[model samples]
Target: MSENIGDLFQEVMAIKQAGEFELISALIPYAGLVGLELIKENAGLITILRNKPSNIGNTTIPAVHGGVVGALLEHAGIMHIICECDTTRFPKIINISIDYLRPCLGTMDTYARGYVIKQGKRVTNVRIEAWQSDPSRPVAAAHAHFLMG
Candidate 1:
């Protein structure tokens, strides 16, 4: 199987159809392994981390793993850039800073949305927020910079 996500990205973007954005996650093994899905919404696309037993970290609190939350935040930013930006290649992460505001329940699905703070020639800055149950109450938030070139 080809592992070139950029090629797949180009193909998907060319189609420009709703529901095709999920294919972008297929080229990313980690996203598939974690059951990440890109959902097209009225506002824009949102990333969802499906609830799974493996994602649970604290059995008592039944919280999702911190690593899992971080991964979702990062992937949300990537997907946002891919779907919204005019890029032929996958963006590289320059740096990311994430804050965990509340415990993410592993039993429930997690949703994340990213907004582009700035898109420059060489760098793009994005802010992502993850929430469960309610969008008003976010479980985690992240700010990430990606190398667009």
Candidate 2:
């Protein structure tokens, strides 16, 4: 699996350099498993998406699973680090703290963006927000630490 991830990273970097845009999401296995898509916007911002039905955690309120949300946020942070740094090896997640602000309605797609708060030689801190429909109203947010070294 680790080898596969490395191979995926190589493919991702290749497409990224080619500016293919849409295919970058295939680099992360978890993203593909959960239907996460990568959207490249202007001003160097990256948005991650999780499409509907497959991500529902609760059918009653139709909320996305907390684990899925966390994974999505973590993936964003990982990507942010990858883009900001020079390494192809996957960053190791040191810790992540998530805040669930509202129910992630399973009917709509979920989106997230990660911000690198502090970056060091061996570690980095990132903040992430997940939303549906409106960026101002995030369904969940997270603070994460990663060991890039």
The candidate maximizing lDDT is: 1
Residue 103 error for model 2, in Å? 0.7
Clashes of each: 0, 0
Q: List runs of model 2 lying over 4 Å from the truth.
A: 1-8
- Candidate 1 local lDDT, 88-149, one digit each (tens): 68899999999999999989999999999999999999999999999999999999999998
Q: How far out, in Å, is residue 92 in model 2?
A: 1.2
Instruction: Supply the global lDDT for candidate 2.
Output: 0.79
Supply the global lDDT for candidate 1.
0.89
TM-score, model 1 to reference: 0.90
Sliding window of 10 residues with minimal summed lDDT for model 1: 1-10
TM-score of every candidate relative to the true structure: 0.90, 0.85
lDDT of 2 by residue, 35-142 (tens): 877766775446566566777889899888889988888888887776666765677999999999999887878888888899888888999898998999999999
Clashing residue pairs found in predicted model 1: none
Each candidate's root-mean-square deviation in Å? 2.2, 2.5
